[model samples]
Target: MAPAAITLAAEAPKLSSANTGFMLICSALVLLMTPGLAFFYGGMVRVKSTLNMLMMSFVSIGIVTILWVLYGFSLAFGSSNGFIGFNSDWLGMSNVGLTELWDGYTIPIFVFMVFQMMFAVITPALISGAIADRVKFSAWALFVALWLTIVYVPVAHWVWGADGWAFKLGVIDFAGGTAVHINAGAGALGVILVIGKRVGFKKDPMRPHSLPLVMLGAGLLWFGWFGFNAGSWLGNDDGVGALMFVNTQVATAAAMLAWLAYEKIRHGAFTTLGAASGAVAGLVAITPSGGAVSPLGAIAVGAIAGVACAAAVGLKFKFGYDDSLDVVGVHMVGGIIGSLLIGFFATGKGQSTATGVFYGDHSFTQLWKQFAGVGAVLGYSLVASAVLAFLLDKTLGMRVTEDEEVSGIDQAEHAETAYDFSGAGGGVVSSVSAALAGTSKKVDA
Candidate 1:
C-alpha cells in the first residue's frame, strides 16, 4: 500500500516545458511595464522633475522584489486564514522544490512565484504617478516597503489566495483589477491627500514636457499588458489565455477610439495625450473582465472606461486633491468599472463558471460579490495608506522642503537631470564650427 501510494504521487502531472517557457516570457513582459510606466509618468512632469518621476517608478522594482523574495510571496499566497496567509516553509522560498508543481498546475512553484513577483513589483509603482515631483525618494521607498507589507499583501491574499474570502465567494478577477489597479489607485489618493498639492497646482501650466515620451511609454505599457493580462491564467493548457489576449487588444482599440471621440467632443480636438490616456484606461478596464467576457463585452467595458476616465481626470482640479498623473481617474475608476462590469458581461463560458447579470440565469449575485471585493480593497487601501503616509510624513518627512521642490526634485533628490542643457550650447557651437570648416575645405578643393 505504501509503495502504491508513492507511485500514485509520482504519477501526478509533470512540469510542462511549454507552459514554463510561456510564463517566463510573460514574467519578462510584465517586468518591462515598470520601466515603461517610468517613462509614462516621467514625461508627464515638468523637465526639472523628470528623473525624479522616473526614479519613483523604477525604485519600486528594487523595493518590491526584495520583499517578495523574503516574505511577500508567503504572505500573499501561502495557505492560511482567508484574510491573510503565512507558511513557515515559504518564508524564504526555502522549501519550495525546483520541480514541485504549483498545486494543480503543471508549472513549477518557482515559475509561478517569479511571475507573481512581477505583479507585486508593478502595483506600488502605479501609485508613484500620483505623488510625483514632490516626494522624498527615501520616504517614497519606505512607503513602498510598508504599503506592500501591510496593504498589498493582505489584499492579494484576500482576492487570490485559495482560502481567501473573496476567492471563496466567486469574485472573478482574472488579472488585478482589484489587487493591483484599485489598490494602487486608492493608495495614491490616500497619500496625495496627506502630502498635499504640488507647488503650482492649478495656476501652473504644468503640461507634459514630452508628449513623444509619453506616447512611447504608453506603447510599451500596451504591449506588455498582454503578458500582465494573459499570464494571469498561468498557462496555455486551456484557451483562456488566447481569449484574454484577443480581448485585451480589442478593448484597447475600442477605448482609444472612444476616448478620442470624447476628447473631440469635449475639448474640441483629439490630443495625443488623450489617445495615450484613453488606451491606458481601456487596459485598466479590461484587466479583470477580459477573461470573463467576450470580445464584444470587452469593447463595451473599454468604451465605458475610456469616456468615464476621461471625465474623471478633471475631478482633481474641481475638488483640489492634485493627483499629479491621474492614477485614480484611470486606474481606480477603470478598475472599478471593469470589476463591476464582470457581473454583467460574464458568460460563464470563458474562465470562471459564474454567469453575469446579462448572461445565464441573469443573476445579480456576482455583482454583489464584486462590490464586496472592490469596497473592501478600496476602503482598506485608502485608510491604511493614508495612515502609512501620515506616519512617514511625521517621522521622516514625506515631502521635500518648498525650496527643494521649486528648485526641482531631480537635482535635489537624485542630483541628475533628464536632459543636459549645459552642453547644448557647446554642441551647437561645435556643429557650426565643423560646418564652416567643411565649407572652407570644399571651397579650397
Candidate 2:
C-alpha cells in the first residue's frame, strides 16, 4: 500500500501538465474566433461604422475577460445547482496545484476555464452586431455583463456543466448549437426589438465598407476553428475530437458554396456577403454536431444549413423586425438546424453511429430532444434578454438619443470615426456628407 501511494504521487504532476497544455491550446483557439467574428460582421455593415462593428468584437476581450476571472467562471462552470455556478470565488486559482479531476490529462482546470471563457466572451459579442451603430457603449458593456450572468452562464451550465440538467438528460451539444448560437441569436433579437432599428432600415444602400476586412476575418475564423472543435475533447488525442476537426472544415466550406449559390440565384450576383454569411451559418450548424457526425454527414449538414439560413434571413423582411445584421437568420437558424439534425443523426452502437430517424432511430426521440433543448434555450434567451433590455433601458438607457442617431453613433457616442479622408480634404467632403446625409434623411422619410 505504501509503495502504491508513492507511485501514484509521483505520476500526478506529469498527468496534470498534460491537461494544462491541452486547455491552453483550446483557449487560444477560441480567442481567434472573436476577430473572425469582427470580419464576418464588419463586412455586413456600412463603412461609416465598420470600425465600431469590429470594435464590439475586440472590446469583449477587455470586458468579458475581466468578468470571467472575477466571478463569471464561477457562475458558469464552477460548482452550483441547475440555475448557475458560484461555488468558487473569482476563480482565485488557489493551491497552485493540479486539480485532481483533470488528472486524466495534462491540462489544468484553470486552463479549461480559460478555454471556455473565450466562448463566453465572443458569444455575447456576436449579438452586439445586431444592435450596432445605435446603442451606447457604456450601456452595451453593462448589458453584456448582465446577459452573461443572467442568460449565458445558466444556459451554459444547464447544457455543459457536470450537473447540468440537459447534460444529465444525455442531450448531446457537441459544441454550442443551442447554448451559444441559438441562445445569443435569440437574445440579439430581443435587445434589437427594444432598441429599435438603425435610423435607416430599408432605404439606405448601407453596403459593406470593407470586403477585404470581411474576407480576412472569415479566413482567420476558418483556420482557428480546428482547435475550437478538436480541443473540446479535453485531451490532445481522441477519435471524436479528430472527427469534429474534419467535420468543421467540410461543413464550413460546404456552407460557403451553398450561400454563394443562393446569392447567385436570389440576388443575381455572388456577393462577398454570401460567402461570409454562408460560411458562418455552416459553422454554427455544425457546432453542436461536430463531435457526433461523420464527415459525409457534416457536408450534408453544412449544405442544408447554408440553404436554410439563406431562407431564414428573409423572415426579418416579412415580419418587419429588421434583424439588422441577421443575427437571428444565421446564428439562431443555423443553431437550430445543427441541433435538430444531430438528434436524428447521432449514432452510438455499431449501428452506424447517430443514424437519423430516417436511418434508424426512427422513433423521433432524438429529434424531440433537440427541439426541446432548442426551444428551452430560445424561450429563455428571448425572455431574459427582453427583460434585461427593458431594465437597462429604464435604468441606464438602451438607445442613444434621436439626435445622436442622426449624427452617427461612431462620432456622437464613441467619439471615434472608422476612417479619415482628411488628406483628400474637402475634395470628397461635400459629396460624401451629402450622400450620407441624404441616406439618413431618406431612411427617416
Candidate 2 C-alpha lDDT tens digits along 1-445: 0000123655664444564676687779789989888887777777666767878788888888888777777777655676676655446555335554443345555676677888888899989878877788888888888888889989988887776777666667877888899999999999888877777777767677778887888788777777777777776544667678888999999999998898899889998878988888898898888877778888989999999999899987788786878899999999999999887666653112445675677787777777788999999999999899999999999888878866777787667787776534564876687688889999999
In candidate 1, stretches whose alpha carbon ends up further than 4 angstroms from where it belongs are 1-11, 424-445
Scored by Cα lDDT, where does model 2 land? Answer: 0.79
Tens digit of lDDT per residue, candidate 1, span 1-445?
0000112565687889999999999999999999999999888989999999888888899999999989999988888899999888788898989898887677888888899999999999999999988999999999999999999999999888988888888888889999999999999999999999999889988999999999999999999999999988888977999999999999999899999999899999989999999999999999989999999999999999999999999999999999999999999999999999999999999997788988964559999999999999999999999999999999999999999999999999999988865453566666777788899999999
> Worst lDDT window (10 residues) for model 2?
1-10
Name the lDDT value of residue 380 in candidate 2.
Answer: 97
Scored by lDDT, the top model is 1
Which pairs of residues have clashing backbones in candidate 1? none
How well does candidate 2 score on lDDT at residue 364? 79
The model with the greatest TM-score is 1
Q: What is the lDDT of residue 69 in candidate 1?
A: 89
